[model samples]
Target chain A: MTVFYVITKFLTFPGAITKALFEHIMCKVLKLPVEDTRCLRTDEMCGHIEHELVERPVAGFWLCFIPGLLNFLLGMSLSLFGVINVYCLGNYTGFIQNNALLSNLFASALTGNANLVSTVNFLLPILFLWLGFSMFVNMAPLPEDALMMKEQYKNLNGFLKVLFAPSYFVMRIGAPLERYGVTFILFAVIAVVLAIL
Target chain B: MDNENKNEELFDEASAIEEIEENDQPDVSVEPEQPEQEQPMEPETEQSVEDETVERLNAMGDEIDAEDLGGIPVTPPDDDSVDEETESELCVMCGEKPADKSFGEDYDLCADCRKRLVKAPISFASILFFILIIGVCFFGFLLSASQLSTLQAVSDAYDQAGSNHLYSAIKSLSSAGNIGWKTAKKAVSLYNDSGYLSGIASMVDAYFYDASASSDTKLTWADKVGKGNLNAPWNKDVKKIYSDYNTAMDAYEKYYAYFSEYDEQLYYGEIAVKDVPYDELIQKYETAKQTETESAGLAFISYCEWYLANMCEKGLETELQYMKAVQEACPDFTWLYLTKLTELQISAGEYEAAEANCKKMLQINADDYYGEYFRAMILRRQGKYDEAIAKMDAVIADYENNGFYYAYYEAGINAFLKNDIKQALSYIKVCYEGEYLNYNTANFYALLNKLDNNEEEYQAALDMISSNQAQLSPTVEKYLKKQITAEEMFNGVGNPFEQPAAESEAAE
Candidate 1:
């Protein structure tokens, strides 16, 4: 793992790794301006926080894809079925390390059957709610993203226009990206999770 | 009470069918040659109207020719008094007409005048409201009575089940279900939700159903066994307990979460104890220790680590370090933890640390009864078993409750290890009747009995563990009345004085 990943893993909440990465993709998707000391001011063309955007253009895709899939899986794996149980603990003691498998080895360790909350698991539920909540609270694109959307709209080729049609429509709504839709989706996700619980 | 008994009899009327038949058969079969049998078996006072009906019919047959035909049997002498009585009964409230019905057979009132005099101007709504009140009261009374009967039936069924009369308990359950269908159904549904009655009632159904199912299986297997079927052993497959276990687990989780809200000890204590990776478990422990929410959670890490070490079979040396580490980290660890850790340290030969732990334990809880015993364990670890026993005896002198008789157990174990059978027998007897009767404890008694030559006591202790084969190990066979030497009995197994090694977890 990278030093950044290790640092984030240790410092962050259980599912924050996925949440952080999703926002990174959202940053690129919206083309939202981020503050940069070098630029002296935030602007539409300012650099993003995701390291891959500054280092290598190709790596940016991986940053988006890896965390996206991970966040989705980690979020969805909160369900008992989506997750797996193993006999890591000694006989009689139940699941010790709950996690997604890695090369037939344990990757993420989950604390299953811990009585932290009767209705909720300590790690996964909090992470899911946080990730889904972030989607609503951060729905609105930055002011600079609105200007960038205009510039990108004029330059888009026919293929690109069709490819980004959904984002394009939302981008045209500008800074007032209308959170009711996102809020409703958030509640739906929560309802489903609670029902599963 | 009479009406309630009548209702219960009505529900059980099917069960009494044979008794009714027995009572009626003699009356029906009675003939001139058996006229004496026609007499009511029951006393005259207790003879039911139905029983008297047979005699009345016979008497009516004899008088049939003399009877006169009539539209009605009118008593004119009584009619004259009835009119006089009616005339005397004037409406007391309105005093306008003679009464239709008397009030208390004294003051009389016309119907309309009585209605007004009763409480207020009578209306249909008031009458209906009175009826509704009566209806609600009667319904509530029936509900409570039915629930009580169900509870009683369930209790009877459970008692019967314990005695292995499985079908009789089931029959009682059937009666309960029939008489209290609505009450029992409500109880089964809302049994665990609230209310003591529902909770107890629900348990009856759940337990009865479970008991019936289990007994049926046992009896089926036993019947086959009696028929010499070798394959008809009791099926103890535990996968059945976990069948649809996820549903119960979900409910349990909800209950745990709700309980943890009020007590973080439940929340953090269990979370810390969960089997996770060493680092993950440590992370939880560290978090709980540092948490400002509840001070009680801090000890969770110490307890968790101690248990994890034990589970992992970490050597005594490692255990010593873990115990010290917990003590060092949690200075204010609870009295129980300190007492437990001090004992572990003594076992690990960390007597100096154990002595310090004992002092820390006493400091934390000055009135702790375990402090002196912990100090004595330190002495025992130093090979001064005799001195340790003496110290333990002093504490036991003032101790009233028999929560743990460690002194008696330890003294016996030490004496037995040294082959001092006579002393072991005497010391072990004092530890009797307390402590969990696990294999080790049972074997302790078995060994004591064998040395003391008390064949019956030894056999009972030995049989206490016939269900588990491990307790019947070859070493345990020494307690059997066989011409075996002590060394031969413990040839493969270690000396019994030490805590015997547990069987493989799979075997369990």
Candidate 2:
């Protein structure tokens, strides 16, 4: 393979996208079915059994939607925290200069828990990166979900197609690349590595 | 015969269709719960009727086979549609009639645009890649941090080197230099642990080398530099600075040795003649065999001459005679020897010989100020006062005259002797206003004032001259008054340069 191939191959795994999708799959599987609760086991008990299956699992669309969104958001937030606290905030000099009040507060806190904070600060980037990439890979799309997206794509008019071209490119190319078993995971890995620097 | 062949073909086709139907049935083991539950009611369902249809098709196949064996010409089935070429498979994406190429089942691709979808390897590797990314980031961070730390160290060293504390400065500079030297030494020590760290860190080799050598040079030179004058010993900030600078040069030499790539550049790997102490060099040079230690001998002799020039304080005349003796013995061996001799000869009042040496001095250096000034002095002593004045003017004109009282004094004295009192006054005025920073210029001002007959100015001038010149011998005073000849004064007094005062304020 040439240099480009080596690079692209290394960057082949979709990280965040796949993680998000995988989480979605889990959420969907764990979710209870709500479509009119059909059951034939002992005709007299069928209604109660259907109610148990549907109501007990608490499978609302929010169950999938909330967690997936929360996971992605948390991953981003933590990575940003890692970057700011670990990378950009070097040796308290800037903080001391910029904010006397906060610096004093931080200094007092540091005096009490220097080792603890330092260790955490040191590991923040690693934890953030790991969890972030995990969520990305877990974000797998279900078959029905994919079919629904295809149906939506087919229904788009010409003007809407032009209007959504960029989004479509991202969905078709970027989303696929970052999907699990895709090179975008590797790219994300490389990017994370670079970002640390 | 054609009808019989057709019937036989129909029988074969019927059997293949039945086999396909049997294979298409759902697995009995898989989805057992769903299938078993459905099987109980299947007698009244579409499945039972489908089974009956299959039995009928089997019967028809059997009949066809019997007919085929009987050699009867059966009519071809009307259901046999007109024979037609098969329609080409169409591409799903572009709706074009595609070439016979397919990537996957149900995916007929066209020749114009065919791309196989390539999947990424390694799944759920977020944590591994994350660790790797962190490792890479930290590697870069560490490299930059190292560089930053080195720079800060060097900066700290510089700050310490500039400090007023000698011990601290010396210690810090030595440490900094050591760091530089070690860094430069390790610049090429790469055995596969290279990355951004080594790439950038290696670039500082030259910087480190330079810092190391400069530090070494300073330290070495500082070791030799003595501290403090007699009155205040070992406590001056200025002294500390000089001492630090002196020692820091050792760093320069070391760095040069360590990293300089050029072949022709000089490197002091070992201490040579210049680094040797003055006393040791003298002792070795005086006793060594000429042929065996020629280079050291030469160096020693040169250094001895320089030492003598700086230390000799007897008088300008003795200094002059010493130079002449060395010159006469060596016969212009070193250009410096001739120059010093000629200069001394002029100071000793040997005008003719000094003038003769001036010609030789000028031959060596045409624009030599020593030759020019002494030449002017010779003319003055020869009683060619106008020519002397003119030459003095020319000499002074060529050089800057900020505080050189002696040069202006010479011109003024000659002008005084020439009876051009106003011109002499002009020259003397400048020399005194220059604060006559040198003690000898007092005589010119006093004499000029006296000749002008301004008794008050003259008396003040005389008093000032008297206050400063306690070393003036009584006989030299008579000579100044023109009451005695130069020979008589020299014969009567011990040393003309000595103060004639039996008790002096300066001595007290």
Candidate 3:
């Protein structure tokens, strides 16, 4: 049992230990029967059990890869656009004399452009990649017995269903809204402000 | 028969006990009567068990007897003592009992609990080790990335500063040697970190172009004279040369300042200085020279006095006399002395003598592009434009081959002034390729555009002129203003030369 627990924990995310502790507490608080508990098991237990094995479909592969690819493309486009703008500005302004007021102003503008592009295009994408990688790591295979046992353990599903159901709405509606709709709205506001100024 | 046998067996076990108890007693104290009574019970039991046992015993009688039993063995009580000693020791980890006993020899660990004890630490350490390794790698990556970013920033700053514009500042910083060099080098290093290799190359170009950036070992001679450390190995000739050079710089600065003020006064129609006592002025100049010359040398003081006297007299001969005196004092002040000699010849209407002196200056400093340009100027003054163009060709070739981008641009301007459009365009192409920035380059391109009747190219050059106007150094601004009218200059231009004009116009 300890070996099974160690192996399962090793395969999970950074906060798996805390998650395991939470699961243990939930089991006790709910007064679940020891016999009904879905405990971590060694591969040897499966080897001993007589059962027909069938391939299970994985949904996370496309979930992770598609978003990762989109983010990469979006970041690349932003970087190229930003660089082009900066290049045009540099060429137009020509040489800025040292210690001159105009030169100092232009220098400040260029520095701002560099910092903005670096943060928005380069840094944000790297962060998204890390988040995507973490999500992929968490999508490991659930055991067959545990999947079967989950049906009997109604509370387990009840708890997770409540926790995860809102995420579906977020992913379906909110993500698209934030990705495109919000961006458009923000841009519109900025344009209006800039026009007025 | 079984009952009789069982009874006899019981009697035999009782008799044997009696016999053993009898044997345990000392021989001297043994009771014969008691033994005789026990012996009867022992025979009875023996006879009942060996009724067939007697027959069996009779058969084994010859083979075995009671005395045949081996000698009685001694037994010790130490086994109980060892058991108590083991029971007293405690387990190292949990201090438990039988469950927490040794797993192996001398290693006290209970079987069930030992697995957790051993595995837990290893598991925790493995997790920690991996986290540490990842953390170090991440830190290293971020550090290098930050360093690269900083380097890029520094490089961009240097590039924006430009070469010719920063020449004087860089030269001043360089002349301070190690102290100045350290700061500039640090700036360059920061630029390199930012991946600005081009900026470093431009800085090196600027360094080489500014002759003043070099050690100016010529100044060290003045140091020797001021310290009066004659015991040190000092070059008497070089010291005398520097002494006169210092004197000339001091006199030039003073006269230039006075002349500039005097010109301003004369322009304002306030020429009160013409009535001032020349003798008193000369005396004051000599007195000031005496005090200031302590830091330079005696020869330097004399040169300053002679120059001031000449300026006061306002006679060409007086200036010539002072120049001759300086020449006699320091024959090795080649560049300055030759320039003075050429000025004297030009003033005396000796064009041939001036041309010869320019040629001599060129010979003395073959790599001096300015010297070559001066020779071309002299030839142009003589109406030998063909010869001047030839000299310009040599200068252009030297500048182009040596990557003297600014010099090449200047040569292009000179060529344009001589009406050699073909040569000027060619040099301008080189300047463009070298990324030299100046208003003149833009103007030359504009002119070429007009000559070729390429409207698009002309507009493009004009746009470039507006863009590059901000980059011009004060010196370049002065030269450009002299070359063209104010109307030709663009609005919003960062003109270093516009200040005086604006001030004067505002006053008016």
- What is the CAPRI rating of model 1's predicted complex? incorrect
**Which regions of candidate 1 fall more than 4 Å away from where they truly are?**
A1-197, B1-299, B363-367, B401-403, B417-419, B467-470, B473-508
Candidate 1 chain B worst ten-residue window by lDDT: B225-234
lDDT of 2 at B65: 39
Worst 10 residues of 3 chain A by lDDT: A87-96
Q: What ordering of candidates by DockQ runs from best to worst?
A: 2, 3, 1
- Model 2 lDDT tens row, B215-281: 4344222111111121223223323323333333333343223223321221322432333343543
- Model 1 compared with the native: what TM-score? 0.29
Off by over 4 Å in 2: A1-197, B1-339, B347-368, B395-401, B466-476, B479-481, B484-498, B501-508
The C-alpha stretches of model 3 lying farther than 4 A from their native spots are: A1-197, B1-264, B272-280, B290-372, B378-508
Across residues A112-138, which tens digit of lDDT does each residue of candidate 2 receive?
553444343345344555545544443
| TM-score for each of the candidates | 0.29, 0.30, 0.30
**Model 2 C-alpha lDDT versus the unseen true structure:** 0.43
DockQ of each: 0.01, 0.02, 0.02
lDDT of 1 by residue, B227-302 (tens): 1111212111111222212233443343334223324542343433233354555455556556523322333445
